[model samples]
Target: MLKVPDHQVAGHQAGHGHPGPLIDDSGRFYKPLQDDDRGAIEAAFYTSFSSNTRVPDHIRRFFPVFYGTKLLASDGSGQWPHLVLEDVVSGLSHPSVMDVKIGSRTWYPEASEDYIQRCFMKDRKTSSLDLGFRISGLQLYESEESGLWKPDRKLVQHLSADEVRVVLKKFVSSNSPIDPNLNPDCSFASSVYGGSSGILAQLLELKSWFEDQTIYHLNSCSVLMVYDKKKELKGESSDAKVKLIDFAHVTEGNGIIDHNFVGGTLLFDKVHLRYSYQS
Candidate 1:
């Protein structure tokens, strides 16, 4: 049976008479197809990307493994098509997840004027313009029995750079109740974001690919960072994973470098650097 994912930290939710992403027992994620060009665009990107032999094997690991599409019945909404994807957090007992939307600009060059204006306004209003990335949502695992510490989406999206750093610290901290004022010890920083297999290293690998590849330009895409808090507390090695998600705004590169994505990724490197030093 397909059910709402408890681990989802961002994007639309199952409310307001609209269905959201669903996951099945087979460790597959089902994302509802949007009722616009975005759905077709995303589908095309995945279909092409999966078969394209040009993408390096190492870089391909950064994205969610695509499994094509499925028609699923919704709650009084009849049958709807959903993109089937690998559930990145499938095995984690207490997963901590964050969604960081990259790029200073989200609209494509060929986007409508109204769309460009909307994205521009939002980019300025949020930290995306200055930081080149913005935290869309996050849920830190407090405990198996205590559930997760999920803040309001609006509060997270509007956070300043300083506040974002605090949140990043909190995500790696071992503290309970998630106190904002408590100085984070960053017990999991080195393990989760520093090791050879850590998020930083994986992102750098992705950045390297973006530096040369001109196949596609990903706009408004997010890097989803996930780790198991239960494992960290148990003194296990970090099982951190970084995967790119959200391809609704992807466009053909037209043989030009995706400077926007490259710049945002570079800024992300700086953010990690600051986080490491400050902690």
Candidate 2:
């Protein structure tokens, strides 16, 4: 049976008579196709990406495993097409997830003037213009008893650089929630974001690929980070995962370097550096 995903930590929600993401019992994620060209564009990108042999296997691992599309019964009588993807957080007891939208500029050169203007305004209003990324949404699991700590999406999107740092620290910390006074020790930083097999390393691998490949320019895409908070609390080894998602705005590179995507990856490197220094 398809149902609302309880493990969803971010993105458009299913409510108020609107259809959103759904998941099946087989650990497959179902993202409802948008009503605009974005749906077709995203479907094309994934279809092409999956078949492209030029993309290295290691880098391809960073993207959600696509299983094509399916027409599923909607909330109403109509059937909707949903992109079937692997549920990145499947099997986690308590997942802590964050969706960080990368890029200083989200709109592509081919976008309409009005669309560009809207994206420009949004980028300036958020930290994306200055910081090269913005936290679209996040949810940290406190415990089985306390449940998840999810802040308002609007507030998270508008956070300053300093505030972002605090939130990043809090995500790795097993202490009290987002309180600065009761600062956490960030015990999971080394395991989750550092080390040879950590998120930083994975992102660096992606950056290396983006530094060369010119096949696609991913605009307004987010890097989804996930980890099992319950395992961290139990002193188990970190199992952090990172995946690139949301390809509605992807465009062909036409042999030109994707400076915007590269810049976003570099910004993530900067974030890791600062986080390391502070921790």
- lDDT at residue 175 of model 1 (Cα atoms): 77
What is the C-alpha lDDT profile of model 1 across 1-279, one tens digit per residue? Answer: 878888888987666656689998989999988878988989999999999999999998888899999999899667888999999888775699999999988887788899999999988888888888889999998877788989899989988877777777777878764655667778888888776888788888999899999999999999999999888999997589999999999999989888888887886676753475345
Once fitted onto the true fold, the runs of candidate 1 whose alpha carbons sit more than 4 angstroms away are: none
17: Cα error in model 1, Å: 4.5
Please, what is the whole-model Cα lDDT of each candidate in the order they appear?
A: 0.85, 0.85
What CA RMSD would candidate 1 show?
A: 1.5
RMSD of each: 1.5, 1.5
* TM-score of candidate 2 on Cα atoms, chains taken together: 0.95
TM match of model 1 to true structure = 0.95
Clashing residue pairs in candidate 1 (N, C-alpha, C atoms within 3 angstroms): none
- TM for every model, in the order presented, reads 0.95, 0.95
lDDT of 2: 0.85
lDDT of 1: 0.85
